[model samples]
Target: MTGSNRPAVSSGWGNLLSGANLVRSLALSGGVALHAVNLYISTTILPSVVREIGGFDYYAWNTTLFVIASILGAALSSPLLARAGPRGSYVAAVLGFIAGTLVCAAANTMEIMLAGRFVQGFGGGILLALAYAMVRRVFAEPLWPRALALLSSMWGIATLLGPAVGGVFAELGFWRGAFLFLIPAASLVALASLFVLPPRVEKRTESKPLPIVQLALLTLAVFAASWGGMGANLSSTVVGMVTALGLVGLVIVTERKSRHRLLPAGKFELPTALGSLYMASALLAVTVTCTEIFLPLFLQELHGRSPMEAGYIAAVMSAGWTAAAIYGSGLKGDRRTSAVRAGPVLSLASMATLAAVMPWTGADGDWLPLALICTALVTGGAGVGLAYPHLSAMILHLAPQGEEDKAASSIMTVQLCATAFGAAIAGLAVNLAGASSTPDDMDAANAARWLFVTVAVAPITCLVVMNTVSFKGADHAS
Candidate 1:
């Protein structure tokens, strides 16, 4: 599976797109799409939900609790899959999602909505984890890059559907309907799973006990960061972040020493390939959150755009990512290496560009600034896309013996954790810069500058960390 040993040309898209694999592919991609679209829909309709339910102070908690629950669900996926089998696990996840969506649809208060969101996030996390874990179980090695790319593309699809669905429902004064819409979508995925997925894994083994201690530490770390970011002042936010970091360090140490491992062995040692890959992946994921979570707000408040317009504009980043991922999946050898190396560079430049331009208010007729903003968004997204599939493949390639399922499931865990951290950091940056839920133009501008500038460090650090990842003996072939 190394670069030198792999075929120059893979089985090609046809192999994955046709026959029995096609149904399986749909099942996997559909799971991710369900999760992603729900995310976008929730984000878009949240303003309306708050306006109606009156939990403006706890706006961020919706995402915070959901993501924390998602981390737990992701950690639990491997064991669930082992015990329940593919079909059962997928069905269980879908049922959970449906239940949560129903709860949100019926919620009369912010507290109820937060509870529903937590349940929804847990199911979404399991869906995401199972999709990645099944990639290895169901497909040939040659198709992994393409499969991963396809899964990544679901975000792009969500970017298109989420805003429209949420916007329509919100505009029509029926935001609850938006949550209701997810029920049928999830049911279809469950139906497909019953038909397409195997009843059980072929070589199933005894399930390991859950890593309770490490899970507790990881949960505390994310919760601390999230709670801190929600603090009323900067000092509390800093303390929360510091505490979160300390908790994360403790988790790393505990993971290293524990027999019931959450991540693969050597994951904490940066010099090791697995360690470097995980670090690079986490950093790239962090860069994404810094801009994406707040882009619509900045566009609407500062640039005088409509909600729908801002939503589509924000989606340009996902479009770029999808295009680049599809293109990058076809590369091999030196070209692939070049693409990987270029990812962080592009992201860094994009962040820097945003830091400069996003803070400035433009004239009514000024389209140049808008153009630059779109360009930067695309560049940053493309950077992550180009490198992500290759990095994922490398991790799977380098995973320790008999731990492949854990490695695959942990991909979602790492991503969710990074996203939570990034959101927390972005919250801190914006709050410190005086951007509240309803900020004045100047406050919004300052928040934009501070947020992008602060997040710019992620890509820079990713660039450094990625360089240390030796691709020797790693798979790069599409």
Candidate 2:
């Protein structure tokens, strides 16, 4: 794949008109929606199921194990897709997913249920990353943006409807019913995938072992993020956080010295096109994933709303995301860059408003809880919707020649990790707030406030890097 082969609208028909493109698009879109609904449904059931199964003693592992497996699966996607190709990979993932579903459907013990969720997450992570990577190879350049937008839109819709849909099923005593039906959905997607995804080009630029060390670093980072949510102490959490940073540093050094770089050689040495793309993508994912993780909990716990209400509120978030994504896609010039730049500020401000008003809507009852939640949802959701796909597209565009899949998978890995990070922070805040913490109110607002401060800080690093760093051949066009 030459530089010209990279996506930049060259066709009158665009890739969107092709038969294979449409089929793959639907398959990818549907597959993602299925997995998302499954997850949301499972989560809705968990809060209710804990009493029937056991107490909080074994509860945290439900999320913890799933996230850990997801990280590992995402890290392995490039390798898996490379070896299996899209057809074989999707088939194998779906089959594995079926097995996990069965485990959950028949789960008599909490351990078995958690294990099923872990495997489910692994399949989900691989499916998402590989699907994004497959888009570059299978579709035409000009149409990639629209295709990505479709994919992102799929996410917003799934998130909006998933919990509510799940709640309906869960309330019907069919929490397991969701996954039972998944067998057919996965089967259909697998069958359809074989017909659409293009064959691999079979090019060998360099054969390198998967970057095991960097993979370890990311795994550790994911662990720290999840562990922190388990209510580990400040000092221990701080150490875990630092360890994650250290692992990241080690990955940089290792990638710099190695022949085959996992995260792109340009991710090191900073300020080149590679670093810019990475920063933009990582930040975009950081905000969006964080928003999705917290919104459900916030609406349900803080506002005394049911899962259905929370799901409806989640749609508002999706509306902001979709509207902003559509707006960002058409804009030219600074509109593009500024949206990326301002994303963090908007996210931070929303968090600020959320923290300030949280007490008013606490368990004691104050003003209109529903209205305040909608406002918070719109602000943060819009900020994320505004930025995620645009940044994602830019990152994919900057991928090294012939390595678009790696770039996509790598970006998804960052997102998966960051999502767990944000959720971990939220989980920790809730646990530390203790049993007295009421659904309407809790003192954990201060902890939440501090975490928001950290989340807000994520993007400001881009500004610092832009000003302070230099690379051999990067030109900042804006």
TM-score per model over all chains: 0.95, 0.85
Instruction: Please give, for residues 314-333, the per-residue lDDT of candidate 1 as tens digits.
Output: 99998988899999987888
Clashes of 2: 4
Reference-based lDDT, residue 472, model 1: 64
What number of backbone clashes does candidate 1 have, counting pairs of residues 3 or more apart or in separate chains? 0
Determine the C-alpha RMSD for candidate 2 after optimal superposition of all C-alphas: 3.9
Q: In model 1, what is the error at residue 126, expressed in angstroms?
A: 0.4
Candidate 2 Cα deviation (angstroms), residue 243: 3.3
The reply for model 2, stretches above 4 Å from the true place, is: 1-18, 202-207, 300-302, 362-369, 426-441, 444-448, 462-478
Please, what are the lDDT tens digits per residue for candidate 2 over residues 1-478? 4223655554332356466666877777766666666776677778656666664677768777777777777778887777777777776777777777789877777988888988888887777777677766666655555656666776677766667666776778766676676778788888888888655535634445887877777777778766655655777767766776677677678778877667654665555766665665566556555655655565666567676776677677676677666555544356666675666566666666665665345445555655775687677767766666666666666677666667878777767776777676656655565333344455544545554555555556545554432322222211
**Alpha-carbon error at 431 in model 2, in Å?**
5.4
- Model 1 scores a TM of 0.95
* Candidate 1: worst-modelled 10 consecutive residues by lDDT: 1-10
